[model samples]
Target: MTTYAVQRSLPGITMEQLAAAQAAAIEASKEASEQGSPVTYIRSNFYPADQRCTCLFEADSKESVEKVNRAASIPFDRVEEVLDIPPMQH
Candidate 1:
């Protein structure tokens, strides 16, 4: 499975939501992270906003990302899996 970085953006992030989402994210992340299932950081971060919350998920696939969002109940309005760029070796 190829690792994927997923981006989720919302139109307002709350403190309570952050906590909930964090837990949800962790759980979802664990699915791939544990036993070295190609999950890396499972990393998630955000700030209180009057009208938006932007989040990024580094994992294995769009489906995994969706699962995370669904688990978190974070009301994701958009998601984009990052495309890996080949490094140019000198």
Candidate 2:
């Protein structure tokens, strides 16, 4: 699976909306896994002050990531394939 970063901009996003979006994503993920195409929602970082968020996911392609976000009714600015770099040890 490849990592993806999905950028979303919500001017007035709330905790409730975030929870609903998560639920939808979970549902989509389960459905995809059952169909043999697994997509995992790794996590999300919310910037309330900026009214923006970046969600991370693991999937075969960006299209799968977009599909899950769409199924969850989540508005996103774009999706980009990302490479994860480990932190340097002191």
Candidate 3:
């Protein structure tokens, strides 16, 4: 699986909405996994002022990520593969 970034353009999004979306994403991912299309929703960074969010997911392909978002009833602007670089401790 590879990490991907799913960008969502949500206008006037609130904390409650974000929480609900996250939960839905998790359930949708589980369902997708059971169907053989594994998708793991990692975490998200939300910008309340901009009404947008960037969510992370691990899946076989970007399409898989998008499928999960759609199944979760979440609207996303784009889905692209991303690289995760860990910080080095000094």
> Among these predicted structures, which one has the highest lDDT?
3
- Ranked by lDDT, the better of candidates 2 and 3 is 3
- TM-score of every candidate: 0.55, 0.89, 0.93
Task: Rank the candidate models, highest lDDT first.
Answer: 3, 2, 1
Better of 2 and 3 by TM-score: 3
* Highest TM-score against the true fold, candidate: 3
- Compose the digit string of candidate 2's lDDT tens values, residues 1-90: 999999989888789988888788878877887788889988888899899989889999899889888888888999999987879999
Q: What are the candidates' C-alpha RMSDs?
A: 4.4, 1.5, 1.1
Model 3, 1-90: lDDT tens per residue? 899999989998778888999999999999999999999989999987788899999999988998999989999999999997789899
Which residue pairs show collisions in model 1? 12-52
Q: Over the full model, what C-alpha lDDT does candidate 1 score relative to the true structure? A: 0.59
lDDT of 1 by residue, 1-90 (tens): 454444456455566866777777677667656645444434554544545555556655666666666755667666676655669999
